[model samples]
Target: MRQAHRFGSATIWQRNYYDHIIRNERSLQPMRHYITHNSLTWADGQLHPCNPSKW
Candidate 1:
């Protein structure tokens, strides 16, 4: 976005992002949980390079 252009760095924005319509509340709850908690597990995930065990 504009911040990435202004900073001359897009380390986070370099990844693809997407948006979707929430047709029902039932579907939104899971996405809400994931959005709130996903980052707590990121460092331990295989896709990420910084595993806490290595520290």
Candidate 2:
């Protein structure tokens, strides 16, 4: 957020973030897997602002 401000751009002027709460293992495990592979998955997930492809 501070970086965006320093760049003279509002964070919201760019994109939104996606977050999920820690649930039970069934749910948590998938999120952990996602986090571990975020870079590989970014091209096809909501986490990448430039990627419109769905997860």
Candidate 3:
């Protein structure tokens, strides 16, 4: 999911993820928050009958 968003395409061929370093804790916390909150944030998309809970 993260790869698809960052690279603008899925990496399903590899069946894995790539990572990059975060500069510091200051940069890291909000990213954690977003990841943690993502399910709620995108719930409407999941709720749509055709979308099928991308999470």
Candidate 2 vs candidate 3, TM-score winner? 2
Candidate 1 Cα errors over 4 Å, as ranges: 1-21, 52-55
Order of models, best lDDT first: 1, 2, 3
Report the lDDT tens digits of candidate 1 across residue range 1-55: 6766799875764357777788899989989999879988877776575665564
Q: What is the lDDT, from 0 to 100, of the residue 20 in candidate 2?
A: 70
| Candidate 3 ranges with C-alpha deviation above 4 Å | 1-21, 46-55
lDDT-wise, the better of 1 and 2 is: 1
What tens digits encode model 2's per-residue C-alpha lDDT throughout 2-47? 7667888755554576667877889899887877898676577675
| Candidate 3 all-Cα RMSD | 8.6
Candidate number achieving the greatest lDDT relative to the actual structure: 1
Q: What TM-score would you give candidate 2 relative to the actual structure?
A: 0.45
- lDDT tens digits by residue: candidate 3, 1-55: 6756788885445556557578999989988987888866674675555567554
Candidate 2 Cα deviation (angstroms), residue 4: 2.1
Against the hidden reference, what TM-scores do the models get? 0.44, 0.45, 0.39
**Clashing residue pair totals per candidate (backbone < 3 A):** 0, 0, 0
Q: Rate the local accuracy (lDDT) of all candidates.
A: 0.75, 0.72, 0.71
